[model samples]
Target: MKLGEGVEAAIHCAATLASVAGNSTMPGAALAESFGLSPSYLLKHLNQLTAARILESVPGPAGGYRLARAAERITLLDIVLAIEGREPAFRCGEIRRNGPVKLDASAYIKPCGVNAAMLWAESAYRAVLAETRLSDIVAEYAAEGDPRAFAASCAFVERHQRPQKSNPTKQTPARS
Candidate 1:
C-alpha cells in the first residue's frame, strides 16, 4: 500500500526536530524551506501532528514547533497515525458477496479472506513502524545520510528556532 506524502514529511520533520539541540523548536515556514515544501501543504500535516498530540505548536515570536515527548518515545507509527490517521489503508467493499456470480447472503457468512489479508498487511506495516523511533533514525543518519545535507538541515533549524520557555503552563502548549 502507498503511504501519503504527509506521512513522509512528518517523519522527516520529526527526525530533523530530534537532531536539534535540546530537542528544540522550528517554525512551519523554516521546516518547509528546509525540505523544499510548500508552506500551506506542510502546515496541513503539522496541524494534524499537533491535533494528534505528536507535536506541540507555539504561537507568536519565539514560536515554532516541538515534539510533545522524547524522540525515543516517539515512533514512526506515531507520526504516521498523526498524519495519515488510524484508519486501515485498505478499504474492502465486500465484493466477495456481490457480483454477476453472486453468492447467497447466508453462504457468505464466513469473513472475507481478502479483507482479512489486507488488514493483516496494514497491521504488519504499523507494527514495523511502531518499533522504529526517531532516535533510532538519528543513529542511522551518520551512516545512511549525506553528512553535508544532514548537518545543514540541523543547523538551519537551530539558527531559526527559538526554544520555548519551560513554564508548566507553556509546557503543555495549546494547538495553534
Candidate 2:
C-alpha cells in the first residue's frame, strides 16, 4: 500500500514536537524548513493533524503547533488517518460480476478472496501502526538513531521553539 508523502511529513513533525519543552511550539514554516519540504505543502498536512486533534495550533506571534495530548497517546495510526483519511488502501470493484463469464449474483455468495486477503493485510498494517505511539518513535530515534543527526535536530528545536509567556498576575497571589 502506497501512503502519501504527507504521512511522512506529519509523523516527522509530530516526533519533532515531542522535543519541545513545556508549552513551547514550533512554527509550521520551521517544521517545513527542518525537513526541506514546501511550507504550503506541509501546512496542509499540519492543518489536517490539527483538525484531527492530533496536534494543536496556537495562534499569534509566539504561536505555532504542539501535540494536543501526550506523545504516548498519539499513535502512528492517528497520524496516518489524519493525513490519509480512513479509506482502505485497496478498493474492491467486484470485477468478477463484470466479466463475460456471466456468473449470477447468487453464484457469488462468498466474498471475493482477493478482497478478503487484501482487507486482512490492511487490517494487520493498521494494527501495527496503532500499536506504535509517537513517543515510541521519538524514544527509538533518540536511543538508536545517528548521534550527529539527533544533536542537530535538538539544536534546531531549541532555536525555533516558542515558549509561551507566563502571566505574572496568575502566578502571584493577590494581597488584600
Candidate 3:
C-alpha cells in the first residue's frame, strides 16, 4: 500500500497549521519552505485538502491556509483520503478470469481471496489513521520530538503566520 508523497506533505502542513495562533494563517509558500518542498507541488495537495474541507484557504495578503475545524476534529484519514482519493490501494483486476484455465463466471461466485485479504488489511490501516487526530500528532511531537527541531518550527511559524485583523474597520493611531 504505497501512498503518494503528497500525503506526507499534506499531513505535515496540517500539523503545522495546528500550531498557529488563533485566526492566524500560514501561507502555502511558507509551508512549502518549511518542508523544503516546491510550492507548486504542495499547492495541489493543499487545494485538495481545501476541497475536502480539511483545511480552509483565505484569500489576499492577510490570507493563507488554516484548519477548517479544530485539529481535534481532523483525522489522518481525512488528509489521506483528500490527497490519495477514496480508491482502495489494491485494485483487483480478476486475473483469475484471464488465465487459460478460464472458469465460468459462476465458478467465481465467491470474492477473490487475495482481494478480500487486501481489503481487510486496508480496513485495519484506515482504522488506525481514522483514530489519529491532527491534535494527537501535534501533541505527541510537542511532548517527545527533538527540542531544537520543535523550537525551530515554532520560530518559523511565529515569523510567518499572519493573524487576521480583529476589526478590519478599526485603526490604531500611528506613532512616531
Candidate 4:
C-alpha cells in the first residue's frame, strides 16, 4: 500500500528533530527549507504532530519546536498517525458479494481465505511499524554520516524566522 506524502514527511521531520543539536531547536520553517517545502504547509503537518503530543510547539521569541518525549518512546506508527490520521492502509470493500461468482449460501459459515490473509498481513505490518521507533531511524541517520545538515537546518530557521511574540505583553529573549 502506498503511504501519503504527509506520512513520509512526518517520518523525515521526526528524524530531523531527533538529530537536532542539544542546544538547538528545530522550528517549522527550518524543516520546510530542509525539504524545500512551504512553511505554512510544514506548520500544518507540525500542528498534527503537536495535537498528537509527538512534538511540542513553543510560542515566544526564543521558542520553536521540541520532541515531547524521547525518540525511543516515539514510533514510526506515531508519526504515521500524527500526519496521516490513524486509519488502516487497506480498506477492503467486501467484494465477495459483488462478482458473478457471488458467495454461496454458506459464505457466512466462515471468513474467505483472502480476507484472513489480508488481515494477517495487515497485522504483521502494524507490528513491524510499532517495533520501529524514531530512535531507530535516528541511529540509521547517524550511520549515514553528516548530521551537521540538521544543525544547519536549525540555523536556517533561526536566520529566516521572525520572532513570534505570542503574549505581546510579555517579552522573551530572542533566540541566538
What TM-score would every model get versus the actual structure?
0.89, 0.93, 0.93, 0.75
Residue-level lDDT tens digits of model 4 in 100-128: 78766677676667778877887888789
Evaluated at residue 11, the lDDT of candidate 2 is: 100
Distance from true position, residue 165, model 3, in Å? 1.6
Clash number for every model?
A: 0, 0, 0, 0
Residues 72-166, candidate 1, lDDT per residue (tens digit)? 88889999888887889899898777778876789878888999998998899889999998888877885688999777766786687777667
Select the stronger candidate by lDDT from 3 and 4: 3
Model 3 vs. true fold: TM: 0.93
How high is the CA lDDT of each candidate model? 0.80, 0.91, 0.90, 0.72
lDDT of 3 at 112: 98
Model 3 is weakest, by summed lDDT over 10 consecutive residues, at 167-176
Per-residue lDDT tens digits for candidate 3, residues 1-176, read 88999999999999998888877789999999999999999999999999999888989988999888888888999999999999999999999899678878999999999999999999999999999988899999999999999999999999999998765684422110
Candidate 4 lDDT at 159 equals 64
- Model 2 residue 3 CA deviation in Å: 0.3
Q: How accurate is candidate 3 locally (lDDT)?
A: 0.90
Deviating ranges (above 4 Å) for candidate 3: 167-176
